[model samples]
Target: MAGIAIDGISMVYTLPGGGEVHALNDVSIDVDQGEIVSILGPSGCGKTTLLNIIAGFLSPTAGEVRMGGTRVEGPGAERGMVFQQGALFEWLTVARNVAFGPRMAGSPVAEATEKVERLLTTVGLQGFGDKPVYQLSGGMQQRVALARCLANDPDVILMDEPLGALDALTREKMQNLVLKLWKDTGKTILLITHSVEEALFLGERLIVMAPRPGRIEREFRLPFPEQALSQPAREVKAGPDFVATREEVLSMIWNMEEEIMGQAEADQG
Candidate 1:
């Protein structure tokens, strides 16, 4: 009855040419309740695909994903997702977008409105509620997206590089925002990111995925959530253990380049 379980799963996709693309190979990961774990990997390693499987957006070729002792066959509100692109509805106002979930789940408008109001402020988007999603700044739009995902109060949150599209400065601010939200919510979180620094800063446990036919290559345990934000990220980023962990993760990913290239060739051949 842990938060979520990825049990010995592998996924294969068939291309139009009748060729098989192996996305995952016997990948197994256990995310404990209220813990935040990050998945890092080289490009084309299917890290995102694994995340999708966990979210029930795709069925695994083999094995299963379970949450709260129940099998995950399709999307459910118990698991909320913050996609990389925000994925907000273009036509809805900010408040409407956040209220969308609860309303659909049979919440009365009065209750949904009240919940939306609280969530907008939680993500620092209080006054932006009535603004058209397109009218808000990039950071604010993302805040709305985050609040929207949280409105239903899911037990687990899955993020696929949610801040990856932001400018460097905005990305840092959003990282802190996400950390604060995680602390407040204490939801089990699975984040997939390409940035090593990001993975280190946000994850309580970090799992590095190997090149194509992605498998767990390395894991690191950190006492990060206990670290005070009184110290700047740059200061923590320079710690001996932090540097070593980053290098270890980076080395594993860099070494996978050849393997990914080979897999691509094999598929092409």
Candidate 2:
């Protein structure tokens, strides 16, 4: 029930030589409770940086971030993160990995065990719970990662290219799964992705960023995802609106890339 507020955030990374690299500049975004937002951009556009700032993994050099109006100073259980790769403990079984969060939070053994079962079922990994993480397929591993995040019952989910590593078929499958989870749980989700198709399919709102002092350059309120909810994802994606939106976003990003290259050339000249 908590929304996120990012106000004028800027991040500057100081190199060993004292040179400063401004990764983000005055980037601001708001994610309402239970809303799903996706971010897209070319490489080095600070998409991940903004997600990190929201997750409280990195403090902004300027401005502040708040979750449900409380300032975000550092990592907390209210926000759960899913990375590009399933970073599950290779040594632990899928069930254990899912149970880890609850146990760590001091939930009773019975309670955590029941929660793990429910989460595993939620992620479609019910029977695979006892399997070692190393044995599961790449897609299944990601499922475990999702289950683990959900087990914590976090108010917000931060996914950094969560489907980027999967094969095309698997990625598409996971896209629907993400939508299902978002609708079923009603938790706020902020996704960072490189695929315009994926973003269009999953995001109720889409944000596009530009690099070299990365910032949000464009945003769209998309109807495709909501449409996909009632229709098949493939049908929705193939619709005229979806295709048109994808092209517009692609052109926008392509222009941003050209601008970045132009700036670099001028700097060298």
Candidate 3:
């Protein structure tokens, strides 16, 4: 079990013409072990940028990331990333895709096979392992993605809208799976989503961000996720607390988005 500490992280992008765009500004957050956190914000709010930084795929221009009390200089097996798309290899079977990490790490064949089978079963794809990646539906592909990440037994799972491309029904089902995985595996999770409902449903702590020099704007520690554990997702979502929190977050994001649009118009004018 490990916690992630992101201290004073910021990102600055230099455009081709010598203009500087600040993508993140002094963003800091802590995710404790076995806890789930979700980041919710409008497009261009640096949510993905933040996730990438934590994944060590991008180096923040300033500050550092630490996990389990050690500095994170680059990508490692302890940190797994799930992108919007499954990003699975079309040529590989589902089982091979899930086993790739363990196999590459030099685990013996039997051990890797057992790990793959367990992960497939965990992700609700026990029999689908023999199926090619191209044969699965969007939801199933995302399940494979989650299973592949788990195969590495990463201490922290970073998800970037892993369910964004799915239909409404599928997305709801995936949300339940994520919550179940979190409770069962006790792995720290940081999910980036555009849905307020998803954020509230999956995150014990929710962060809302603002763009144009993206930074954390608001955060809520809510009980909706824990509530969802005992109740059906739909029922939990319909609860008063969920509805109230959803409205509050939506209103804040909408106001921030309006401010962004107004600033853009003024700059053009």
Candidate 4:
């Protein structure tokens, strides 16, 4: 029942030209136990950078990240990550790729088989396990990646635009699939995406981050556990509150993008 605590994470990177780039400043967010939190922002808004910090791939310049009670200094099995390109090994079959995590952890093949099969079913890839990773479409490959991450049985899942490359229809399908898996497995998930509609639909809690030194801009608690998945998405989206939140986030990003662009313009002027 452990969830991640991101306490005032701040990061600054020095460019080769000697200028400092402030990526995130005091970006504090928390995903409660079994909560699905979605973060949305424009490009260069440090959304992926924030995910990297949570995965322990990049250390914050200041502040701390903790799970349960222990601090995170580096990557661990408890934090599983999925990337934008699916990042699957082309040489491995779907089943083998899914088994990689458990095998590395020293779990016997027989014991791991059940988990693999269940995850494949969860992602709608149940019968494609024996296929080569290259044979699948982009959307299907991401599904395999989702299945692979679930096979590890990690405490928290961090995803960086995992469905961003798919076609519009496929992306919608994957969005629903993500909701299904989160509800079924009760995994603590922190997903970073640029789609405001997605953040509103898939997340039980919505976290909005501002750019030019990413920090918490806003947060909203969902009204119900199954509000997003209980009915037709089109119908649910027609509700006034969903539309209002969507517009609010859109305005936030619009302003942030303008500010970033204006800064660049002023420098040129």
Candidate 5:
């Protein structure tokens, strides 16, 4: 069954002078339960806008989103968001942060504590529970964010560039962790990423969006994610098919960017 359905979604913003900017145009996608999908697009392609609409943080100007046959009206406990920067409360310790969702939901004290502990361990922060979020490194903090999202036991997780801020080595390690968590939890995940390679590695199904008014440009079902699950990520990325696919995606996005730039120049001229 489809976990989330986005039908004919279009978003328009009214400018100060009453001009309108169309951010997304008739974008539609149905993500299956437990699927890992990644979105990639240029700067103005409305990737984040689409994600926010699905998360119920923003209402689209046209169309609607549904989860399990129910129209999404607003934020609910079943959908969790992990932002580019870890949005944890700085004053809260790692344990409290991870426990926030369950605690807010009125879970029994003992149950919430046990869940937090297990999640911390699952995210590799078992011993750092008592530390303030400020004390951790960038990568570790993101791990906490992932655990906090999982603590809610949400059916769908929306990640907006969750690994965008990490250093290269740390980002790679986090990528592996994300795949492991996806495999273990069987949760549906929709991740928005700027990096072509990251999108290729993390997405079982990869979506490329078009510019101007963002819409689905191309979709690819790749074997790399499954391959990376059992083999070293570096090796999987180095395989011939992976290299070929990466080049194809890169060229597609690069051409879109060039066209956008040329259009902007012409408008200015």
Candidate 6:
């Protein structure tokens, strides 16, 4: 089971000046195998901090993260990450970038080559194997990043604003591609994004977080992602149910932001 369990997680950063910043407060979440979950929150809400904790890149001051019933103490092959910048080696060819993981793991040449070819085709980059990553468009670079992450065959994929850099059309296309990949691979995915619409579209479960000592504000089980599997994403987004949910979530975040600003003003005054 590739399910994730985050229990009683909290993070406190000790500032150099003698104070402490409470980044997260007893945040706990359970993600079942093959679940696609999206997290949203205002800036400083610790969304990325939570993700980094789950990725084992940072340890919480209290509590632990478990995957497949084992505690996650550090990064492992069972997890892969896709970043906002499509963090690929610009000097490497697309195929080489995708194959980097398997090669590092000492996969046989023939097997790794086969995997790379299949993944390129999976990501719609089949014929562009030899092209340097720098030569690709932003969207194409992201596709390569996706393929590279898939190459590792991780049970879980962590994405932090993976589509945040793209234009509208490209972002929508990438959103659909994400759905397709999730459907085809059945990998557990936890994505952090600022876009409420994207969160609703890609997540079977959507989580909203609040800032001051960050914690889960609300958890919603949404139908849009399942609906999107068969329908055009635009059509799904246009539906009354989807639109209503998006507005509600937007308002929720907006209110949180307002509260934060008010608090800041009070402190200054």
TM-score of each: 0.93, 0.97, 0.98, 0.95, 0.98, 0.99
Winner by lDDT between candidate 3 and candidate 1: 3
The positional error of residue 114 in candidate 2, measured at the CA in angstroms, is 1.4
Residue pairs in collision within model 3: none
Q: For model 2, what is the error of residue 161's alpha carbon versus the real structure, in angstroms, after optimal superposition?
A: 0.6
lDDT per residue (tens digit) for residues 39-62 in model 1: 888887789999999999999999
- Candidate with the larger TM-score of 1 and 6: 6
All candidates: CA RMSD (Å): 2.1, 1.2, 0.9, 1.4, 1.0, 0.8
Q: Which clashing pairs does model 1 show? A: none
**Mind giving the per-residue lDDT tens digits that candidate 3 earns over 126-208?**
88889999999999999999999999999999999999999999999999999999999999999999998999999999999
Residue-level lDDT tens digits of model 4 in 1-269? 69989998889999999999889988888778898899887887788988998899999899999999999999988998989994999999999999889999999999888888888887888899899999999999998888888888889999999888889899988888888888888999999888888888878888888877777788877643377667776776778888888898899889988998999999999
Q: Output candidate 2 Cα RMSD.
A: 1.2
User: Model 3 Cα displacement at 257 (Å)?
Assistant: 1.1
**Which has the better lDDT: candidate 2, or candidate 6?**
6
- Give stretches of model 4 more than 4 Å off: none
Instruction: Look at candidate 3 and tell me the lDDT of residue 12.
Output: 100
**Per-residue lDDT of model 5, residues 1-269, tens digit only:** 34899899999999999998999999998899999999999889999999999999999999999999999999988999999884988999999999999999899989999999999999999989899999999999999999999999999999999999999999999999999999999999999999999999999999999978888899999888899878999999899988999999999999999999999999999
Q: Show model 2 residue runs off by greater than 4 Å.
A: none
**lDDT, residue 160, candidate 5:** 96
Clashing pairs in 5: none
Those runs of model 1 whose alpha carbons end farther than 4 Å from true positions after fitting are 228-230, 258-269
The candidate, 1 or 2, that scores higher on TM-score is 2
